[model samples]
Target: MGYDEVARSVTERGELVLRRRTGTDGPAVLELRANGVFVMDTAEHSSEQALADAALASVEQPRRVLVGGLGLGFTLDRVLGDWRVEHCDVVEIEPALVEWMRDGTVPHGRQLLADRRARVIVADVATAVAEAGPASYDVVLLDVDNGPGQLVHDANAALYDVPFLHVVRRTLAPGGALVVWSAGPAPQLLADLEASFGHAEEQTHEVRLQERDEHYWLYVARPAAGRPEASAAG
Candidate 1:
């Protein structure tokens, strides 16, 4: 069992590397690293799938979706499973990662992007959310960083702040849902979501990976009760 360096790139943030671990012990895994920190891998992504599942279930009609991160394409893949999802916009800050995925460095990258319903935007998610029109999406997912506690980039801390959260809220349609994938039970993040959305709850999901148990949190939030009462998109 060894890791083969498949691709490497240095962005303004730091070093990003993609490695392939192959051996008879199990199926090969593709790992992504940012600034020497483990970001995500193709090992166990039940939580990722759950992130999309929980969001989709919250909304009555899920047509336009925006994914904050494109980690191994797990969350996006799960979102597209629902026939109701007409279009999904994926925002990834790293051009190299998107290139790697689209160019087959990641096994399912091409097939995932090839989906006509999906589009990838190479830009900061915070910027994307802020510039987006009001009530533009039915579902907005944030898997950009691990969590507020563990950040791959120092700048990503803004994503969890109250101002940015308000920006996120503005983009969600009436009755829409926003799900943030966190690595830990970030109490501060939960509070911020509650403050911004007027309705926020923490749902915990556990998964076993590399023979160890790990817990992930999804901070599900909706707009305040006093907002307009438009019906979900048909």
Candidate 2:
């Protein structure tokens, strides 16, 4: 009942809206929706942090990283927090989301983008990954869609397929790693990852939300030639 529309935009892709809900305590939470479907919120984001943490831990020197899907900037912020990281490039397809984050519409967006080492590119992640130079990044983290299943945007499904994955693998450095965040179990994704990267590990995380505990999946993969063990992360 206390939800206030913060920002709204319409594009050929879909309609995106940002809303803020005020409660009795704490800050008002911001929620983002696309075409009437819930995308992400500022409330629960442990899985987002895990995505970055997992990828960063897997690589030996994760100085350069590419993060797909900026969401609420949690993953990028988490990646930048590590002193060892020198630069991070975030590729997001939605210009509205990027604008919202940069103009302070998304609250913490400005501070997160203020980091000198962080760069945000307004372009489709799939295209960006494909066009990237070989061995360009030490880590690649994708939080683009809801995973292979329950896809809010049908076009994002290509991200899970083999072709795009191969491109992602090509974009990784020698010891680089990739971590994808899925809203639920994507069993077939493991096989796809194994096929693309030659190794895949699935992590089912129990996300503690305000009202309930939700399970999210994180798929970790290293390039085929590499079989290094990823360091454990919380």
Candidate 3:
């Protein structure tokens, strides 16, 4: 068995401790934990990449993308993999997390940051999304929390509510797609997305951890033709 050690730790805006762990196996087995909650690890990030893939696949010729959370940079790297992706605006709430990735605190962190089309924004994702103009992006990919069921912060609950989702809807261009990565199935979140988007679909990705199989959920939604604007206008 490999023993784990804290490689680095920092207290961010929310007063939560963000930590990077290194396992005995080597640097490849690094994990990011927030307030003792496992945010993500570099070991198996297939689900993160899957979130980007599934979202991009749903749209054609996605020019501008918004990724809400940097994590280990897996989702951002996957988004930049496709040539059709022109620009990606990544919003990560923790400046320390962003700096960690920039300063090589995590392996594979520089991949997406080096891409010309990638822009890393250290701010609250919800605020960034809400402030964006209408039809600003063709794809909005979110991997901000563990899931609605397991949030790193309680305040993140607002991001899954109807009102914030409405803001997300307006930020997407006509026919644009919104993809959210969840640690597990969140029925209420799905229901909210359906009500807000007029349509929602769930895709599950199986991840192998040691001897067991774990599943991650991705909820994809598209803005209903005129519903978003009409609701806000009315």
TM-score leader = 1
lDDT of 2 at 130: 76
Cα lDDT tens digits, model 2, 27-72, are: 7889888889877788888888989899889988999999999988
lDDT string, candidate 1, 51-93, tens digits = 9999999899999999999988999999999999999999999
Best by lDDT: 1
The number of residue pairs in model 2 that clash at the backbone is 0
lDDT tens readout by residue for model 3, 152-232: 888888888888888888888888999998988999999988888888999888998534699889999987766736243
**Order of the predicted models by lDDT, top scorer first:** 1, 2, 3
Q: Per-residue error at 206 for model 1, in Å?
A: 0.7
- RMSD for all candidates, in order, please: 3.8, 4.7, 2.4
Off by over 4 Å in 2: 226-234
Give the Cα lDDT of each candidate: 0.89, 0.87, 0.82
- TM-score of the candidate numbered 3? 0.90
- Candidate scoring better on TM-score of 2 and 3: 2
Write down the lDDT that model 1 would get. 0.89
Q: Which runs of model 3 end up more than 4 angstroms from their true locations?
A: 2-7, 12-28, 226-234
